[model samples]
Target: MTVDPPIRLGRAADAAAIAALSRELIEEGLPWTWQPARVLRALQHPETNVAVVDAGDELVGFGIMEYLDTDAYLVLLAVRRSDQRKGRGSALLRWLETAARAAGAERVRLDARRDNAAARSFYNEHGYHEIAIQEGGYHGAVDRIRLEKWLRA
Candidate 1:
């Protein structure tokens, strides 16, 4: 019987691995912007939360969320391919959402590539609604679907 890794706030030391995971899983087919330096900046940002799941050996998943006055922006979320469908992604998302709500955020927003049906379905299952579609949103190269979830009435 083996227990799964726990999700926690990402540390500066985890920046490189998190950025690598983001590049491999989330930023695929797009320009690489979430590099280690950028990730470290997020880790140190006052309004940003960089959550990560450490698998002892390395980071198996990570999510970055920025909290604002009225809402939160889920900048990125991704779990390792081998760890998908095991609730890790959901746990990360829920953790981020709870933090946002605690910060007085009434809504959470994110974007997914238009071609990623799996990602769209995942967000839909988690109560996010499609708010709009931005043509060539990713570096003016890929179409993106914007999603939002209201945390309160």
Candidate 2:
């Protein structure tokens, strides 16, 4: 599932589009936790980052990552349902990793729900390994599985 290359850094004007795409793609309560307002806040935040894959003017996918110390935390990633399996997710992820490395991150971390097999597979295929899982990790609705990947040897 490969597409064209070059994922871009999301901007302030992209907040609405990113938020809309997330709402359409995410099938959980996490989007409800942040919503568009929270996304806008992240856009303005210095420690957080947002990257997107666009097809012309339409944003097809996005990922939000936060830099904490020497680690980059992937807070959220979503691709348009119609655009899934087309490499957008992977491209955005790669871009995030590059950004993180440039910011001195030695490793990247993310969390997925235990019920999300597809997400778990994606992370695994991208070199991320499960580190831990906490019961009722997602607002007591689902267990959150933490995954990590070292960027450098």
Clash number for every model? 0, 0
- The whole-model lDDT of each prediction reads 0.92, 0.86
For candidate 2, give the lDDT.
0.86
Q: For residues 5-91, what per-residue lDDT tens digits would candidate 2 score against the true structure?
A: 668778888888887776665645653666678899998899998888887778888899999998999999988878888887888
lDDT of 1 by residue, 34-117 (tens): 999999999999999999987778789999999988999999999999988988888899999999999999999999999889
Q: Ten residues in a row with the worst lDDT in model 2?
A: 24-33
How much is the lDDT of residue 88 in candidate 1? 85
Instruction: Identify the leading candidate in terms of TM-score.
Output: 1
Off by over 4 Å in 1: 1-5
Cand. 2 TM to true fold: 0.91
State the lDDT at 90 in candidate 2: 87
